[model samples]
Structure formats: structure tokens, C-alpha cells
Target: MTAADFAGTKTALALASSDVTMREAFVETVTAAMDTDPRIAVVTADISAGNFAEARSRHPERVVNVGIREQAMIGVAGGMALTGLRPVAHSYAPFLIERPFEQIKLDLGHQDVGAVLVSIGASYDDPVWGRTHQAPGDVALIDTLPGWTIHVPGHQDEVRALLSTALAGDDRVYLRLSTRRNSRAHSVEGFTAVRTGSKGVVVAVGPMLDSVLAATSTVDVTVLYAATVRPFDHAGLRAAVGSNANVVLVEPYLRGTSAHKVATALADVPHRLLALGVGREEEVRAYGTAEQHDVVHGLDTAGLHHSITHFLG
Candidate 1:
């Protein structure tokens, strides 16, 4: 199977509209969940609170707005979790994960509580806001802690499905939402094989799938799509690699965020891995659009094609 193989599939046409973003889908899915599931509560740091006006009106106690204090937002979610409420924390990526990281590490992780941390402004999604609003290292930072189910949905439909699953469980989950999306959503049961070839294996994380597909369209390599990244699909990846252990991981977060997992998964098998994503070598001083930043980080289609081809060679 290859990129062409996905053409006209039912899943591809289900929600192919580019208008429905992952964040919007999250708000819709979560807000609806609040109606049925009394345990589903939301904690926000003044981000997207207006979008939840109806939910807040219906369930005042469940919907909390912690002003601009990101720390307090996490603290509130932790408190709610302690009281057996499934808290969903929302904010920009930097504020949600980076700003009050200590509170997350201690208030939630140390307290052994569970909450759904939903974030928008993925990496440099709003690069015009500058680096302060960006958080490419969010996933990498959260990886340091244990017992987190990190979800990076590539499409709005996937977001709805992943968020629904997270809400159904009492576990720590980081649902990273973004403006970036693919043309369609995959069923996403672990690392799904989108394309198969004998040259090498490329694992596309979340929104990176479209770019990865285009980059490897001509190359004789297998492409795997991963929406649920944390519980890094070790078995799926190992199976994909089979004998040809040349692997390339294309993540939307910080470069090499899941490189260690890949390394560990293929520990016994001889493999050459190329980890591509937002580069950490230098700070992107210039403020520009997210697409421009993608070029800077070599995450754009051309950049990905160049790097992937070089690695496959």
C-alpha cells in the first residue's frame, strides 16, 4: 500500500473538510461529553473559555476559568482529579505544558492524579506570536514523567475519537491539538501502516503524515502513521521494520522526541534511524508564519523529502 492506495477510501472521505480543525473538534467532543459524563470537568487558563459558554452555563462547577495563571489551572485540575473528577485542562501549548511545568510534575504526577491536558498552538503554529507562544519541546518534556498517554491527533475526527477514549479512562493524558491536519483521518490503531515498501520504514506522527506521505511517495519505503505516540507502539513498529530495519521517525514536536523509544524498540534489530521534526540546534529568531517556521526546522515537504531521501540512500 502507498499514498495512492488511500484515495477514495471511506475514512478519507468521512471528514475531509479542511475547515474542521482539531481544536474545534476537541471543544465539540469534550463539551458534549460533559453533558452525559458528570465526571468530565474542564480547567482553563483563560484560553477558549468563551467557546465553552454553554457548558459553563449548564455545569458551572465543572467549568473553571483560572484567569491567566497557568499554574493555578493545573493545580485546579489536580484538585478536581483528587476529588474523582475527570479534569480537562486547556491552553496554548507553551502555557499548558512549559509555563507551569513544575505544577504539572508535582501537582498531578507526584499526587498520582489523572487529568486531560489539551493544548493548541502546537509548536510554532502561531509563529507571529514569537517563541514565547511556541512549545516544540512539550512532548519531550512530558516524556520525562511517567504514566502519560500522549495523543497527537492529525485530524478533527481523530481528535474526537482520542479525546473520547481519554475521557472514558482515569489516567494522565496529554491531548496535543493543532491547526495542522491531514486531508483525512486514519482509524489509528497504533502505528498504522499507510504505505509499505522494502527500502526503509518511515513513522509519521500526527500531522506529519501528509508531509511524510508526499516525501516518500516516490521512494521505496514503508510509511506508518501514529496518532497515539506516548505508548509508543513498540510491537507495531517492530513488525513494520521486520528485516529491513532502516527507520525514519517524523514527529511534529521537538526533533527526536520519540527517538529513544524507537531506539529501544529496535534495540536487538540492527537499524538506522533518522529523527526529523522541529530542530533544536538554534533558536528561530525571526518571527514568521508556521509554514515559514516549518522550512526553518526542515519540516516542510521539500525539507522532509531532502532529509528522507538522504537518509534512505
Candidate 2:
């Protein structure tokens, strides 16, 4: 795919109705699936459980609320998985992945169980809630464990599709949802090409696609959109890089989260990679909107443009 392929489509799609959020879509998709699929179960830690009222009413035994206990939530989900149930756990990013990481590593990874772990409040989605709500290292931490599928959907449509795909299989999957979204959802198989250029390739993960497109609008570089980051698409990236091999990875999570994967992907090919994302050097204690945080972390359009142009040069 190239810029010409999506010319004028994104702007038009952005104007269309977008009242449905990723969380709502998750609830709807999982609830409808529960009506027919008895193996599917939803486990929540007092977050987003109200949205599943109808589903819980119908299948009380399956839809469980473990209250504010995130660790126990994972434990319960793991228990359910042991009993042949497909558990889908939900909570904020920090509470879901960061808080109960030991449980995840032990209860799921150690036990060799499969569950669909869903999270909201991506990074600093609700900045007013402060660092406790922010989890820029979620994906990076999950990477430490083995056999986990990570899906960071850029739009509600993508969310529905990816969630369905995860629910269909009994794999240890992590679906990262965010309030930020792209204007449109691309048919992402693996690092889907949105624009082709010769100077280099700019890999945009999840919600970073739109900003990436804006940043490299005039640059001669290929832009790749990755809704699924884990099991990094080595083949697609290798093909995109061709010979130039100058790559810029623009992720919404911690900086260099996918740098190792990119390095491994292009290990044989000599390449220069510039990893851009939330900074870990220092924590910003100020309360601001997510966009402000983006600017602070050099993830805004301007920040991305500056970094891309400098790296390309």
C-alpha cells in the first residue's frame, strides 16, 4: 500500500460516526460471543464490569468481578483457564499488566494457560489520574514473558477484529486499547504498508499511525502501520527496508520497546534504527492532557517530524 492507495479516505472516514469506543466494542463483541460460545469467560477487576451487566445477567457463572484485586483477578482467570474456560481479563493498563505482573508470569506463563488479557487507559490516556494510571512500559514488560500475543489496535474496528481473532484461539494474548485512535483502520496483516518511500521506512505502531503520516507527509520514506506489535513482523519490515535499511520505529509505548525485535529482524542487513516513544529518562510530574504528554515525550506530530527528518538526514 502507498499514500495514493489511501488518498482522501482517512479524512472522510474520520468525519463519519465514531461514538463507539474500543472498550464498548470489546464488551459488545465478547458479550455477543458468550451467547453461543460457552468456553468464553470475562473476568474483570472492578473496571468495565458495569458494561458487561447484560452479559453477566445472562451468564453469571462466566462473567466474574473480582473487585479491586488485580492479582486475584489474574489468579481467578488462570483458575478458569485450568478448568477449560477461555478467560478474558480486563482492567486498566497499569492495574492489569503492571500491578499483577507476577501473577501473569506465574499463573499464566508458568501454568501454561491461555487467556485474553485486555487493557484500557493506554499509557497516559487519563493524565489527570497521574502516573498510577499511566503504563508506558506495559508492552515492554509483557515482552519479558514468552508465548504472549500483543495486539495494539488503532481503531474500534480493528479492536473488534483483533479481539475476535484472540477469542477464537486459546492463546496467551494481550489486547492493548487506547482512548487515542487513528482516523481509519487499515487491514493489518503485519506491519501493513501505508506509504512507500526510498529514503527509509517509518514503522508506526497502533495509535501512532496518524501522527506518523502527518510527520512524514513530505518525506521520502515508507510508512508501515503495525496494529499487532508482538511476534514482530520481521518479513514485512525486511521487505520494506529493501537496501536503504534506514528505519524509524515510532511506538506509543516505552522507547526502544521494539528496537531489539527490529535489530533481530534486520540483523543480517546493515541498518540504522531510530527508536521514538515515551521517554524513560525522567517522569513528568505535571498533570496535563494526553496530547500534552505526547509533546513532552516527543511523540506529537512536530516531535516525530523533527526526529524523522534528522534521522533520515
Candidate 3:
């Protein structure tokens, strides 16, 4: 347990109660940074009060509320960033990325302006909000850009780590912070192997960590929680799975984004291969909520367990 290369000011963050949220952890970190650096700004695409109450209370003026217009809010945040202000643009995942694809890609990413994009209640909590709101393909779509750094906190701790790193770095970062209770992970300070085994490698992204652990234990396999997706932990995974003939990737994103990318990376390599992800081709219609969909799509406990077991055996 050596010190992280850059843990920010909250080294004691992991020592907290169980009710913490990655969204909260991330906000707290940003709030702290803002306390020191007046140039740090927080922007909201209409839902600032609900998603970032803590942040707004502290920096009321810093929170540039645009009242539901996500695209315009992002443009403002980008403008702020280019003007030497570190801005965090907060909004719902679906609207933030999908609704403003052109703005984010062109105005923010292509401009090379670094703004931290935080999407709250990210993947599947809105069972009642229906498909349009429940699952946002933010991580999958944004990560496609060349330099965007993607962060999906499995738990509060990992959220803190990634947020801390993103705050200190100059790269554009997108975090899909889950708004669901069950979607929280315990948090690992740095992106390190949660566990490793010899049979094969299981790379779990986001809150699918439990499924990964279950599959590995059931099959006596090795697994890695890729807390960060953009960079893809290429070196760490390669070292861990070095000469193995089997590797599996599990993610909450649509198949095209997460697992598929991993499978393609190892496409030419020698190994048994499998990728488990939500199918993007299907029209999203709020079948039941993200959790229910995970179960249906086999991203949940039963599904992940099944996918890993069948793949390994």
C-alpha cells in the first residue's frame, strides 16, 4: 500500500461511512479544490440544484445554472475552461452526452478545452424515468474520442481517486457516477488489480464488480476491476494475463464500447476470448430500470456469473 502517485488532498477519504456516494465524493473533492483555487468553476445543465447541491451552496456564483439546456451549458463550461477556469459541467448522462454530442465533441473535445463532465444517477437507477433517462451511453460514446479520460467509480473510494486525478490533470474527463444504491463499489484508491488468478483475466468495469468477483470465485479465475476505461489499463492487464489463453471483459456500457474494445485489443493474441456488455443496437425503452435490464441482459449477478462460468468452462 504505497502512496498513490497523486492522491490529491484527501488521502484520508477512504476512511468513511458506508453511505457515501461517488457523486458525493467527487463533489467534495472538487469543492475542496475550489476552496483553494478561485479559478475552479462548477456548471450545471439545469439540474445543478438536485445533482450538485453541496457544490452550489459553497460556490453559488461558480455554479452557472443553465436550466435544462445541456448543450448550451456545456458550451459555457468549455468557454470557462478555455479562459483558464477549471469547470465541472454536471447534468444527466443521457442529455449531457447524447443531446450535446456535437457540442461536446466539437466545442469541448476538439477544441482541446479541458472540462470535467460529471453525469449523476448515471446508469440504470431511473426505473421510473423510463429508458431515455435510466441508462445513459455517456461512457461508451465519450470514450471514443481520442483524448477524453473516462472514469466510472465502482464505489466512493475509487470515485474519489479518479476525481482527484482528473482535477490535477489537464485531460478532458467524463465520469458516469451511478445514481443507484446498489451501483456503489467500495472504492480502490488507485487502479490496481483487485485480484488475479491464473486461468484467465476478467476485466470488470463500473459497478459490475460483484459479478466479476462471483464469476472468478465460482470458476477459480483471475479478475481486474478497470476503474478507469479510457486508458484501458493496457500495461497492467497485459502483465497480469501474460501468456494466458483466456480473457473476458465485462462492462455496463453497450457492447460496442467497453467489452468489444477489449476483445478487439486481444483479437490477434492467443487466448480464449469473451466480452459481456449491454447491446446498443436495441432500442432503449425502459424495460424495467438499469438493474432489471442488467439482469435481463446478463450483466447482473446471475448473468455475470453465467457468462464467466460458461466462458471459462
Candidate 4:
């Protein structure tokens, strides 16, 4: 008898893997969260038809298309939270976080209501759209908001995990997302050792962890993937570094990300923390596809390998 065919089973697994895009994963997560809680709603800027177009069309009644008013969208989302409704808003990183920051800080966060702010297509997803749209520093501003929980999922798996966790959370969450599929942070229910660097470590957040994980085999290195940025897991971090650990933080956001905060918390270790990210002055030339941007920021695997070798060697 001929060997039983396994092509059909393999194909279904392959298709299942391919069908889960980051945006779709987020939409499904949000939809389920909203379904479990009727008070949940979504708001979007004019970009609803662009980045969130599919989700908007998919969940029309639950999503509020706030048009081009970035600030207004955030303000209204904060208002919704007052009535005990969970409002999640999506927009370009810079516009959503920067334009409506006051509302986030004073309205939703200060008032202690559950409001979710999602910023998509961050850190150089599109070059044609140019400088104004690509936001590497988007998460930093929200990171400044004292009660805000900021999450940057560096891999597809982490994107789904973080989104689900955040949607189920009761506090204010700022989710900065990258549309590029390749770097999805490997999602674990909590945190795990993605890679290990012998001489030192790259404690990373967002999708930059992907390149770090890949680069580790080339060089002797270790990477602790920080899927949840705000309200850090200090216990996990302590366990990651048993005694002596020299580290660097890799994040897609600006220098002041959770990586920075985590590094600061490790002052007693006498370890060096190298911050790998883009800042304001450097934002001008920081425009391109995800790969192009990561390469520019020294964020790709080659760059991660080089950084590991340069620092350790």
C-alpha cells in the first residue's frame, strides 16, 4: 500500500499559521473581550479605513469611527470609560499617543478607568507615507503617563498574547503595534528566555526581540523577552539575572521605554545597559519598511550580533 499522505494535514497547519496576521489577531482578541463585556467599544481616527479598515468593517456597531480627529478620538474614549465602559482606540502611533496625551493622562488614567489605546503601524512600517507617520518614539509618551501600562509585542505570538491580556486587563493600556509580520515576538503566557548570550544579555521588548533571538546563535548571547512593558515583572527579571548579568535593552520605541525603566531598576547589579532605539532628532531619516527601519536603527539580527560582539568582546 502507498504511504498515507500527510501533505493535506501539513497544508492545513501551514495555512493556519499564515492566516493569523497581527491585525487580525488583535481584532479577534478585542472582539472576544468586547463580547464578554458589553460595555466595551472601539474608536478610530480617519485611519479606520486604512490600518483598522478590516476590523472596522468587521465590527461596525462596536467600533466608533472618529474620523481624522486624533485628539478627539482619545478624548471620547476617555469619556466612555467614565460610564464604566471599556473603550479601545486605534490610530497611527505618533498621532494617537502624542495628539491626545492630555486626555490619556488626565481623563482616563487619572480618573482610573479602563481605557485601551492602540497605536498601529509603528516604527517604519511604510516608507511612502514618510516621516510624520512612522513613530519610533510613540510608546515613550504613553510610557510617561504614570498609570499607563504600555506593551510592545515584538513577535506575532506575543502580539496575540499581549493583546488578549491587555484587553482582559482593567487598567489603562497603551499598545504600540508594528504591522510588519516577520518580527512578531514569540508569545508565551508570561515571560521566558528567548535566547541566551554567554558574556551578556539583551533584555528586549517589542519585536526587536525577534532579531535578538536570531542573532544569539551567531554570537554567545541571551535575551529575556519583555512582552509586558509597564508594571514590570521584577520577580521575573530577578530570576533572569541570577547574580552577575551585563545587559542592554532592545526596544522599537525611543530610549525611555520599559527597557530603560527595567535597566534603571537593576542599578545594584553594576551592569551596563545599552539602549537600542530611535530618538526625536534621529526621527527625520527614520522612514522606511520594517526591515529598512530596523537596519537603520541597528535593530536587525546582523546589528544585534554586532552589538553583542562589540560590547562583550
Candidate 5:
């Protein structure tokens, strides 16, 4: 449960070339979908130009740019939704979620209308951008409003599946994309089992699977992989945990956001739970690569292994 336990481990590893980034897959999938469905409109706060260039060129009228105004971006999306158009809004994590919290609450939540709120910065995606652009609380904030289905896809394949599914629905959907990703792509929905153990269970949400695997490789615990956290697979979790009430949740967002659901699922059973994720106690303020931020926040394999080992004991 200490640094010595992870002594010779290579914590930071790269993905294969075949793997597609979540951002790339989402833009490509959505743009292609626009040709068949004219009801799909894209609204951006000026951050996703690289991905939207093709969509902008082909369907200029369908794409709306609200400059750098995050609030206006949501407002515009809400308006379009009312007119029978399904709007997909995009921006940095904080600018999209925190800056326009009220707009999302009033324009989207209050009106009972919905938009596909997609974002790139998952917590500290841009450690170089510092705290202003980071949003570890986006999911927690979204949980404030009821009926929002949140998708935290770990790979490009999952992104494509979730985006297609969300676009077809009329309810509020938040697709959280991150620079942090898993080594491989998982199935579209539900929890996938990576390993099994009898002592307890560990649930790795989206991009957290790789690190969770590295952390629990030697530990005796069932590992469950989830690409969709909200609308949390309560049944899947309860089934995986079975008689073992000891559970560990590793997510890429604010810690303990789904703690309540886990508790609710195991309410009748006596349980002890540990929640690991990005810390919200203080600002990171460090300027470096995203990996460095992972180290500081204990999301890396070494850190995660250390935490899990201690928690299980």
C-alpha cells in the first residue's frame, strides 16, 4: 500500500495508433449523421474547430458558433431544441458546465427541453491550462438537475456509440470526453468484467479501467468496467458485488459523486466503500503535461494501486 509496492512499475503508458481519440470519433460520427438527419445542429463555444471543420464546411447553416460565450451557447442550443432541432453543444469542460451553470439550469432544465452537452476537458485534461479550464465537478453539477443521462466514454468506439444513442434521444444527455483514455475500447453500454475475485469488487468508470487493471492485477477483487456512469448500472453493480459489500469506485470526475447510488444499491447489505477520483479540496495550479496531473491527483497506476491496496486491507 505504499510507493514500495509499485517500485518498478511503468505507470505512464501510451495507446496504440489504431486507437482513435474520443474527440475525433465524436466529430466524425456526428458530422456524418448530419447528412441523413437535418434535425441535428451543432453549437460550439469556439473550442472544437479542428473536429468541426468538415461539418462547418458542408453544413454551415446547421452549425452555430456562439464565439466564446458559454452561456449563450447553451441558450442557443435550447432555442434550437424548441424548434424541433436536436442541438449538440461543445466547449472546454469548465466553460461549458460551470460558466453557464444557470443557463443550463434555467434554459435547459427549467424548460424541460434538452441538448447534447458534449465536453472535452475531463477534470484536468489540460494540466497546462491550469485550474480555469479544468472541471472535475461537471458530473456532480449535472447531477443537481434530475433526468440527465451522463456518458463517460473511455475510448473512441464508445464515444461513437454513445453519441449516436444520445442524438436519437430527446432528453438531457451529457457526453463527457477526456484526453485521459483506456488502453482498449469497451462495448457501447453496460458494465464489462475484466477480472473476478471473491474478497470485494472494484468498479472502473470509463477511462479509469486501464489504471484500475494495473492497480488490481494482483489483488483478489472483481473488476467491473463502465463507460456510462450516470443512469449508473445499479443492477450491474449489485450483481457484481454479490455478497461482498466491500466496494471501490474509481472515476475520472469528482470523488463520491456516485457514492450515494452505490450506497443506495447496497442499502440493505452492510458495506464499506472507498471512492477515488480527482480531488476538489484545492486548485492544482501546476503547469505540465496531463500525466503529471494524474500523478498529483493519484489517478496514475502507481498511485491507484497504492490507494486500492490500502483500501482493500
Candidate 6:
């Protein structure tokens, strides 16, 4: 599928190797959750209707559309949460997190209330939209707010697992969906070891796993896959470390968002670190396909391999 396919309307399942888009899994999970529990609700900020037609038709009362008002969308979800209802709010990452940051901070964070803040277009999911739509700082912003569980699901099945877990809880949670997806589904919680090697370890967050594996195909390094990274699986990370103790964090979001956690996780052990992700030094004003952005940012497999080689060597 092309970048346009992901940016366009969400439709029937288009499975590649038995894997689906994270958004599809989200709609299915939320729809099913709402079916079993009346307290659950979904709020969208003027997104496409094709993706959520089933939920809108089946439970019009529970599914809300606040129009272009991204901030108001969060406020509405916050209000709903205060009144004994579980609200799940969504939009493109920028509209969801950047535009409505205040509402998320005050309306929900301050009130000590919780809602499931799901967003698509992670980082440069739709690179053609340019910086106005790109959001590499979404997770970083959420990091500032305490007590928020962040789930960066790599596959649709993982999206289902994480979304279901988020809805089942009352704590504030942010589920980040993206055009980038992993071919494999990791249903297990926490961090799962994808490969083991004697020369240090690499941590791949969400959709970065597939590229990471391809990048490190010839390298001797253990790879740890994280579907849910908020709580940062310290134990699994510690366990994944090998004799080299050199670490590389391959996150799909901002570079070094988890650098602190990684450093702290292996503080006792001597380790060198290289954090990789979208750069924040300047705006990538250019617009094209997601691959174009990845190429520019050195996120493609070749680039990843180069970075890993330099870091490990």
C-alpha cells in the first residue's frame, strides 16, 4: 500500500501477511468495548466518517464529533470522564496533542481524571501534509504530564490488546497509532525479546521493530520489542542487555524521548547510548511520501543499519 492509502479513508481490512492497520483495530476494539459496556464513548475531531461508520451507526449517542475544535474535543472527553463515563478522544497527532495541550493539561490532567487519548498520524505519518500535521513531540508532551500510560502499538493486534487494556482502566492513557506498522503482532504485554545477540542490545519501539530487524540483520545485537513503552519495562530491558552493554533506542517519535529511562535502567551497568528518531533541530518543511521523510531523517533500513553499525563499532 502507498502513503495515500493510509492517509485516505479507512476501509475494509487490507491484510498484509495477516496484519491490519492500527486504526482498523482501534475501531473494532472500541466498537466491541462500547457494545459490552455502555460507559465507553468515542470522540473524534472532524476526521473521516468511512473509518468509524459502524460505531456511529450502532451507537450514535456514544460516538461524538466536535468538528474542527480539537481543544473542545478534549474538554468534552474530560467532562464525560468526570460524569462516570469512559471517554476515548482521537484526532491527528498535532490536533489531538499540540492544539489541545492546555485542555489535556488542565481539564483532564489537573482534574485528576482519565480518558483514552488515541491519535493517528504519528510523527510524519502523512509527510505530504508537512510540519503543520507532523507531530514528533506528542509522546514527549504526554511525558510531562504524570500518571499517563502511553501505548505505542506496532501491529493491529497489539492495538487491539492495548486499546482494550486502556479502556478497561480509569487512568489517563494515550494510544498512538501511525501509518507505519509492524508485520508481526506482539500480543504479550511489556517488552518481548525478538532476537538475542552477544554484542549489546537494541530497543525497537512500536513500528520500528520491522525496520530494526532488517537494519540489524547482520549485526550481533539483541533486540527488545516494546508494544507498551510508557512504564518502560526496566526488568525486560535489563534482562536484554548482553556483554557489550551498548544500547540503541529506535523510537518512531522524537529522538531520545526514552534516553533518560534507558540510561537510568542500565545506570549500574556501563553502557554507551545512541538514540534515533525524528530530529527536532529544525522543521522538515519539505512534503512528500513518508518514505521521503524517512530517507531525509535516516530512518530507512539502510540509514538505521549505518547508525547501528557506527554506534556498535
TM-score of every prediction relative to native: 0.94, 0.95, 0.86, 0.86, 0.92, 0.92
Which ranges in model 6 have alpha carbons more than 4 Å from their true place?
1-19
- Can you write out model 2's per-residue Cα lDDT over 130-209, one digit (the tens) per residue? 98999999999999999999999999999989998899898999999999999888875798999999999999999999
Q: Residue 179 CA error for candidate 6 (Å)?
A: 1.5
lDDT, candidates in the order shown: 0.92, 0.94, 0.73, 0.70, 0.87, 0.87
- Model 5 earns a TM-score of 0.92
What is the C-alpha lDDT profile of model 3 across 1-313, one tens digit per residue?
Answer: 3357346324445345356766677777787888777878888766655656766788787877888788898899889888888888877788778888889998888888898888876666666776667554677678667788787777776777778777776779888787443344554432467776777888777777866786567576677777777777666666767788687877777664665555556666776768777766666565565667777667777777877778777
Off by over 4 Å in 2: 1-17
Q: Least accurate stretch of 10 residues (summed lDDT) in model 1?
A: 9-18
Q: Report the C-alpha lDDT of model 5 over 152-175, residue by residue, as the tens digit.
A: 988887888899989888999999
- What's the true lDDT of residue 39 in model 2? 98
Q: 84-180, model 4: which lDDT tens digit per residue?
A: 7778888778788777778777777778788788777776677668877767667667667677777777655666677676676678888777765
Top candidate when judged by lDDT against the true structure? 2
TM-score-wise, the better of 1 and 4 is 1
Error of 6 at 152 (Å): 0.8
TM-score of 6: 0.92
Q: Write the per-residue lDDT of candidate 1 for residues 1-313, one digit (tens) a residue.
A: 6667676565566645457778888888989999999999999888899989989999998999989999999999999999999999999999999999999999999999999999999998898888889999999999999999999999998998999999999999999998989988997679899999999999999999999899888999999999999899999999999999999999998999999999999999999999999887988889978898899888999999999999877
Superposition TM-score, candidate 2 onto the true structure: 0.95
